[model samples]
Target: MPTMTAAQRRDLAKQEFDAFLADCPSRLVLDRISDKWVTLVIASLADGPLRFSELSRQLAGVSQKMLTQTLRTLERDGLVTRTVTASVPVRVDYALTDLGVSLQDTVRHLKTWAESHVPQVREAQEAYDRRAGQEVGA
Candidate 1:
């Protein structure tokens, strides 16, 4: 077998997932967590578990279909867990797994950043729109 050069050895030792690479597995995770519903759902569970109805109410504009899909995706990804209790109608609750809890700080920061940057984003959008309008009228 050919011996690896020191540089080659170092590169192999330092290999890590890079989302910018088209085939990196981390991109799948990035895609999943970056969804608006995923972010909101994770943020909503920061307090504790919530029932489907409760989550729907808390999430404002999310449709029942969208919320169900979001919850299912999160659960499948091991970031959340679903619990069921027998009742007049079976009750289901969704809660974060430890993996999900670990993500809370990042989720919180993202939510905060978006909330804080609304004015800047709006200004940028309005400016771009005005420029586009002028270009079209010119």
Candidate 2:
């Protein structure tokens, strides 16, 4: 087989996004998606669009600043949409975009899996700690 030129290689790389590559742009997307706030926000929005206060109330312990930042990042990434309506009090709502909807199920499953496996994870951590302690003692 013939080898491609540097320009050809660069073109191919541009056509495909590989997260495993150190410099691939997909890593930035992965980093955003992997954030705990992103996961929770995606999962929360899966139900339906919610006002800012509602989303914050649903996600306990997430400070207002953090939530705002997460929503802005998500919006910039095209994973979520923000709608503003004029009312007695200016109203703003957050909803998942088509892309965000596609991602929500996967995030939901991950959240559910973590919640379901907490006991097993704790056991594994305990066992590892015990082994480490014994090694130190030895």
State which candidate has the highest TM-score: 1
lDDT of 2 at 11: 82
- Tens digits of lDDT, candidate 1, 68-100: 999999999999999999997999999999999
In candidate 1, position 136 carries an lDDT of 100
lDDT (Cα atoms) of all candidates against the true structure: 0.96, 0.95
Clashing pairs in 2: none
User: Per-residue lDDT for 1-138 in model 2, tens only?
Assistant: 789999999988775797777888888988999999999999999989999999999999999999999999999999999999999799999999999999988999999999999999999999999999999999
Give TM-scores for every candidate, taking all chains together and pairing residue i with residue i: 0.90, 0.88
Count of clashing residue pairs in every prediction = 0, 0
Stretches of candidate 2 above 4 Å error? 1-11, 14-16
- Supply candidate 1's per-residue lDDT for 106: 99
